[model samples]
Target: MYLKHFGLSELPFRITPDTSFVFANRQHQEALNTLLMALQEGEGFIKITGEVGSGKTLLCRRLLQSLGNEWSTAYLPNPSLDPDTLFLAIAEELGVKDAVGLDHFHLVRRINRALLDVARAKKRVVVCIDEVQAMPLPTLEALRLLSNLETEKRKLVQIVLFGQPELDERLRRPEIRQLLQRITFHCRLQGVEKLEIGNYVEHRLRVGGYRGDALFTPGALRALFRASSGMPRLINILAHKAMLSAFGEGVGRIDVKHIRLASKDTEGAKSLRWFWF
Candidate 1:
């Protein structure tokens, strides 16, 4: 709605994970480096945990995009399935043929065969499972078992888990200690820093096709950082709504009042009544 008004070709703050809009802040870059290093080292399992809006999914997508042609990737965005179904999903993603009707044993054999084929081709396989905290204990064990599929020198398949903070708590359970032990590398993602908010906003705006002067005033930026607590998702939400508010008022620039209105209208955004210049 505010595209033409803000001189933007597209909405800058859509919550969906678009790699083009990635800010590459300190936390995200460090996490990405850790993941790449772990994958290169042939680590068995790697875990990334963050608060709900801390850009885990975006980083996951960015990792997938950064991978070279030598990698065979399987992305499981939904992990709510049972153990059998989980294996089937991985098998299907790996291009295992005739996997739909196979029993659990047969399916595992087929998946192992496919992974071996990939290994023989001198390529690596990576399985990224998002929202993994919701996965059942048995299913997680099944995942550990899948990780057991390896060659003499290195793992045949590397598993990367992207999930909320609850995933850490779930991993502490005795039922899945074996799986926890397998996580050779882990990283905790945090919110955007206060200093980075300005550049972050500007970066997203530039990617969204804004070629005009700064659209958010200094006071608006302060109010946004306070309201969003530096979480990228909340920043996007408040910033988008603030732009819409400015647009509705026939204004080209956003101010503190716009952010106040956006915060009030947004869930999980902090109140800014005590935030003064």
Candidate 2:
């Protein structure tokens, strides 16, 4: 709605994990480097956790994009599948045409055969599971078994888990301790700092093709940092709304009043207390 007013080719602050709007902040860049390096080293299990909107999916997409043709990838955006269904899903992803209606044993056989075929081709396969905290315990165990597939040198299926903190809690259960121990590398995504917040807003605007004078004043930006707790998704939401609020008042630039209104009007903004600075 503010596209024309902002001179933007597209909506810059959408909630979807759009790689086009990915900002290369220091933490995010470091996480990506670590992820790429871990994958290259054939680490069997890598876990990346983040608060609900700390750009986990965005980074996951970036990882997929950075991998080359030698890498075959299967993505499970929803991790609610049971063990049988999960195995079948991976089998289907690896092009197991006869995997339909297969039981767990049959599915595992099919998937292993596929992985062996790829191993023969000297290509690595990565399985990325998002929202893994929602996965059933049995399903996670099945994933652990899947990760056990390997060549003489390295794993055949590299598993990257993108999930919220609940996944960690679940992994700590006694039954799943072995699975947790298998995780070689892990990191939690956090909100940017206040200074980085300023760079962040500008980064998204520029990425969205905005070419204009300064849009947000210093006071407005500072207010945004406080209200959003420096979370990128919350910052994006508040920023977009502030721009619209400014447009509504026909203000040439966003001000404290506009940001205040945005913070008040956004659904969850009023609930944040002094827990975050």
Top-lDDT candidate index: 1
| lDDT assessment of candidate 2 | 0.86
Residue 103 displacement (Å), model 1: 1.6
| lDDT tens digits, residue span 130-217, model 2 | 9999999999998888888887888989999999999999999998888999999998888788788777888888888889877888
Clashes in each model (backbone N, CA, C under 3 Å)? 0, 0
Pick by TM-score: which candidate is best? Answer: 1
Look at candidate 2 and tell me the lDDT of residue 89: 80
TM-score of each prediction: 0.98, 0.95
What is the per-residue lDDT of model 1 for residues 54-117, given as tens digits with 9 covering 90 to 100? 9999999999999999999999999999999999999889987699988899989999999999
